[model samples]
Target: MTAPSAAHKPVRKSRAVKTLGFRIAALLVISIVVVVGLATLAARLVFHKPVDPEAVAPVARQIHILITLAERDPQAAREAGADVRDEPARGRVDPKASRFLKDMLAYTGRATDATVIREPNSPVLVASVRLKEGNWLVLSALDFSPPNVWPGFVAWIVLIVAGSGAISVLAAIKVTRPLRIIEEAVESVGPNGELPHIREDVGGNEVRATARALNRLSVRLKAAIESRMRLVAAAGHDLRTPMTRMRLRAEFLPEEERGRWLSDLEELDQIADSAISLVREESVSGDAETVALAPLLESLVADIAAADLPVTLGRVEEVDVCVGPLALRRALTNLIVNAATHGGGASVTLDIIESQAVIRILDEGPGIPESLIDQIFEPFFRVDLARRKTIPGAGLGMLIAREIIERLAGTITIENRDPRGLRQTISFPIAGVADGLLSAQDVECT
Candidate 1:
C-alpha cells in the first residue's frame, strides 16, 4: 500500500494518567518534602551562629571578674594574671555576648569588647576592657569541643511534621469530594432513569470531561428507549387494523372452516393487543408510593383461587417497599400466571431476608429444561414450537415482568426445583417504613 496521508496516519495513544487518588497522594508527598525543606532552611538561618557550651560558661564568668577588678583597681587587676593583656586581644566578637555582656560592662563605667572563637583545632573566648586610668586589660578562656546547634531545633522539626500532615489531609478531601458526588450520581442513573448533571465548574479537566460524556450517554439512552417504545406502539396499531379486517372476512366462510379461520385471526389479534400492552407498561411513568406487599399478594392469590386456578399463598411477612403499586402487582400477576401455566400450580411465600423482602413462587408441574431456561425471558421466545399450539401467548410475559421488576430496583431469578417444577424468587429492597413492625404470621388464602 502507498503511504497514508497525514490525516489518515495512525496516532499513538498516550498512557493514561494516574487516578485522582494517586495524584493526591503524590501531591501530599511533594508538599511534605517542600515544607520539611523550608523548615530546615529556616532553622539553619536562625541558628547559623553557633556557641560552644564548654566555653560560654567560663567566658561569661571571666568577663564578670575582669569588669569587677577594673572598677576596683585597674593596675592591680592587670598585674594579678599574666593571661590578661593590655592591648586589644586577637579574637572575633561573639554575637550573643555583644547583646548581653557588653551592656553589663558599659553600665559599670568600663569600655569593653567580648569575643568567642571556634577554629579547627583551637576554640577560645576572650574579653578586652579599658580602665578609667586609660589602661587596657584582657581575659581569655580555652574551649575543646566542636560547635553545637540551638536547643529549639528539635521542636521546630515536630511542628513542621504536624503542619504538613494537616495540610495533606485537607488537600485530599478537597480533591476527592467532587469524585464522590460523581460516583453517586452515576450509580443512581439506573434506578431513576436519569443522570444528574455534574458541576463542571469544579474538579480537574479530565473529571469534568468524564461527567459531560456520561450526561450525553444518559440522554442518548433515554431517547433510544423512547424511540423503541414508539415503534412498538405504531407497529401494534398498524397490525390491529388488518387483523380486524381478516376476522370480519372470516365470518362468511363455511361453518366447519370458519372456526379455524376465526381462531387464527383471534390469536393474531390477541398477539397485537399483548404487544401494545407491553409497550404501554414499559413506557408508563408512575409515582412511587409505600405499599404493603403481604396484603397485595394475599388479594392476588384469592382472586386466582376464585378463578378455579390451582394457586396458594403460604407464609408471608408484613413487608413494605417503595414502588409503583400498579406496576408491581402486574409483574407479580404475570409471574404467578406463568408458574401456573407451565408448572400446573404455584405456591408463593414471602419473608424478610438480610434487609430484603424475598418472595418465592414454587410450582408442581414438569420443570423447564435447563438449556431453555435462560432463553424463556427473551421477547417472542418459546421453549418448544409444539407447545405453542396449546399455549395461547406471544411469549412477552416474562420479559415484561423482568423489565418492571428491574425498573423498581428489584431482582427476579428462576431455577428448577428439586424432583420436579420451577421456583421463581424475587427480592426487593424494604422501605424504611417497615422497621419495628409486629412479628410475621402465616397467611392463608382460601
Candidate 2:
C-alpha cells in the first residue's frame, strides 16, 4: 500500500505544548525587562559625582540673580537676557557677591552651578546641588554632556531575556511531553481508530482527571456495544423457530390453498432469513484472516453468472486486505444480488485505488433515483414503487452488507452510470501482498 499523503491527512500541532511555551517565554521576558531597567538606574546613581566648584561659583551667582528677577518682575529678566553667563575673572572671589554663595559655603564650603542661561545658538543643561540651608543650588551647564549609563543595563537585559526564553521553551517541551502523548491517544480514540497508551504523566491534577474520564468512557462504550450485540443475537435466534414452523405448515395445505399461502410464507421466510443474516453480520468483529481479493472477486463473479445473471469479471487484480472470509463473501454476494435484481445484472470490476481496494459492478438496468440512494441500505426499504416483483425479499441484504463492510472498516457506494445504469463501488484498506498469475485450471464455481 502507498503511504498516506498530505491531501488525505493533516498534521496537527500539540495545543498543550504551544500554550506552555508562550506563557513561559512571556513571563521570562517581562522579568528581564523590569530587572534590567532597575539595575540600569542603580548603576547610574552609584557612579555619579560632582564637578569642580570654583569655576561654578560665578555662574551660580548669575543664575541666582536671574531667578530672583524672574520671580519678581519676570519681564525684566526676559529683557536683560539675564540667563546668559561667562567664566569668572581670575582673583580671590567675593563669596558675598554671589546670592547662592552663602548656601554653598555653609555645606561643602564651596560654590557650584554658578549660572543659568538662555542662548539661542547653544543647547541648555540643568543641574541641581544640595546646600547647607536644606535648599538646592540650581544651574545650567551647556558645554558638557551627561553620563551614558543605559547601555550596560540594556545589554544585560537582552542577554537575560533571550536566555530565559530559550530555557523556557526547552523546559516547556519537557513539561508538556506527557500531555502531547495523551492528546494524540485521545484523538485516535474513535470508532474507526484505536487509542494508544499514554506515557509520562506530567501535567498535575487536571491531566490525571482527564485520563481517568477517558478510561471510564472507553469501558462504558465497550459494554454498551457488547450489550447491543447480545440483544440482536437473542432476538435473531428466537425468530427462527416460528418462521420454520410456518414454512413447514404452509407446505401441507391443498394445492389451491397452498399457492396463495406459499407465496406469503416464502416472503416471510425470506424476511426472517435476512434478519438473522443481518444480526450475524453486524455482530462479527474484525479479527478474521486476510484474503487475496483477486480470486475472491473472480469466484463471486462466476457464482453470480451461474444464477443466470449476466455478470462478468471485467478486470481483476490481486490485493490482500484484512477481513473475515465469510463476512466479506456475504457482503460481495449481497451487492451482486442487489445489482442483478434491480440493475439487471452487471459486469463486476475490481481494482486498487490509492491503497484502497475498489470493486465496481456496472449494470445496464435503470439506475436508482438520486433521492433514494441513502434509503437503499435501510432494511425493508424497496426501490420498486409498484411493489410488484417475482423475487420476495425483506430488503435487509444491503443493510447486512453495510454492517459487514463497516465492521472491517470498509465502505460501499452506488452511483448512476452515464447511459442509464448503476455502479456499485466497494473500497477496503489494502494490506501488503505479492502479485500472482491467474491459472485456468483453478476452480471456477460457475
Candidate 3:
C-alpha cells in the first residue's frame, strides 16, 4: 500500500475508550471501597479505649500481697481471698496477661510463676500462681475480655467489607443500566433512521426522563426528514412537466435561439435530478457488500480518461471495503470528475492506512479559498461565479459525495494542497476477504 499523503491524517477514536457506563461503574466501586475502609477505621478508634494506670494500681497491689502469702502459708492464702487449687486451672489463657503479671512480680524483687486465663462464656480473668508448697492458688482478676471481643470484631469487619464490595458492584451495575439500554437502542436503530420506542413509564426518574426525551426527539426528527425528502421529490417531478413542454416549444424556434433555450432547459433538468437524487440518498441505503477498492478506482479512472477528461490512475494497493457498489461508484465518479474538470487534472491513488482503505484524489488547479472551504459541502454551493460559468454541474457533487460516503460508515476529508490545488481523501474500514474482491481481470471498465 502507498503511504498516506500529508493532507490525510487519522484522528483518535475517543468514543471507543470513554464509555459512560464503564466510567460510572468504576466511580461507584471506588467510592464504596473508600467509604467502607474509612468507616471501619473510625469505629475501631472510637471504641478502643486506652488503659488508666491509676485504676489498675490497687488491683496490682492486692494480687501481689496474695501471691506472697500463698508462697509462705497455703491455708492463710485461701483466707486472704485466694482460691486454693490442687491442680493447674482448666482451659486456655491470655499469654500476654500472664507475662504482664510475671513482669509485675519481677519488678517487686519477687520472681513468681504465673498464668492468667479467661474461660469461654466467662467475663472475668483468673490468675493462678505456683506456691512454695507445690500447690496452686487461683484468684479472680479484672476483665481482659476486650482482647477477645476485638479479635472477633476484626473478622466481622472483614466479612462486612467483603460483602459490601459485592453489594457495591451490583448497585453500580443497576446505576448504569439506563445508559446500557440507550446504547443498545441506538445500535438497534431501524433502517428507517428512527430510534425504536423505549419505555418511559418504568425505571428510575432519570431513566424515564431520558427515554421520554429520546422517543420525542426520534418522532420529530423522522417527521422532519420525511417532509424534506417528499418536498424535494415533488419539486423535481413537477419541473419536468413544464420543461418538457418548453422543449417542444423551443424545437420550432430559430437554430441559434433553440440551442440556447435547449441548453438552459437541460441545465434546469440536471439541477432537479441532482436535488432528487440527494434526497433519495439521504432517506435510503442498500445492503453493503465487500468489494475490492483498487480495481474499482482503476476502472473509474480508465472510464473517465476515455471520456477525454484529464484523469489518471496512480499507485493502487489491493484492499476490500464494505459498501454498496453502485452508490459508492457514483460518488467516486462525481468526486473524480470534480477534481479533473475543476482542478485541471486528477491523479487517484488507493492505499491502506491502519486497517482503513484510503483513496486520495489529487488535483493541480487553484485550490478553494480557505475561508470558503467549510461551505463547499453545502447543496448548490458553487465557489466563485467564474468557476461556476466554466464548470457544467448543479454544484451538488461534493455534497452528495459526502452523504453517500458517510452513509456507508466511511469518511471524506478535503484540504488544499501546498502551493495550489485541492486533495480529497476518502477512507472506509477495511473488510478482510470474506466474499471475494473481484480482480481487475474480472471487472471491465464501464
Off by over 4 Å in 3: 1-23, 26-54, 60-158, 187-192, 196-220, 242-266, 284-292, 319-323, 353-355, 369-374, 429-446
For candidate 1, write residues 1-446 as lDDT tens digits: 12123222222222221256556756786677677768777867787765434435555556667667876876686577634445656556556644445554555444465544333354555545554454555655444333454455567556766776677766766677556555655444543255545556666776687667767877887788778888988998999888878888888888999998887877777777778878876665455677899999999999888887789999999988866788889899889988887779999999999889999999998888999888878888876788777977777888888877876667899999899999999988788633322111101111
Give the Cα lDDT of each candidate.
0.69, 0.63, 0.76
Per-structure clash totals for the candidates: 0, 5, 0
lDDT of 3 by residue, 1-446 (tens): 12122112222333533365456556666676677767767987898886554556567777777767877787787776678788668778888888877766666556778889878888777888777777877887775334555676668657765776677667766776666656645654543466666777788887888888888988997898799889999999899999999999999999989988998898899899999999888776655677899888888889999999999898899998877888999999999999999899999999988878899999998899999999989988877776555567888988889888877667899999999999999988787531232211111111
Which pairs of residues collide in model 2?
59-114, 59-115, 60-114, 60-115, 83-117
Ranking by lDDT: 3, 1, 2
Off by over 4 Å in 1: 1-186, 191-194, 433-446
Task: Choose 1 or 3, whichever is better by lDDT.
Answer: 3
Query: lDDT (0-100) at residue 313 of candidate 2?
Result: 86
Q: Score every model by TM-score.
A: 0.58, 0.56, 0.63
Tens-digit lDDT track of model 2 for 262-359 = 68766766776777776665543534566888898888888888988777788888888766777889889888887887777778888988878988
Instruction: Using TM-score, rank the candidates from best to worst.
Output: 3, 1, 2
Error of 2 at 411 (Å): 3.2
Residue 155, model 1, lDDT: 73
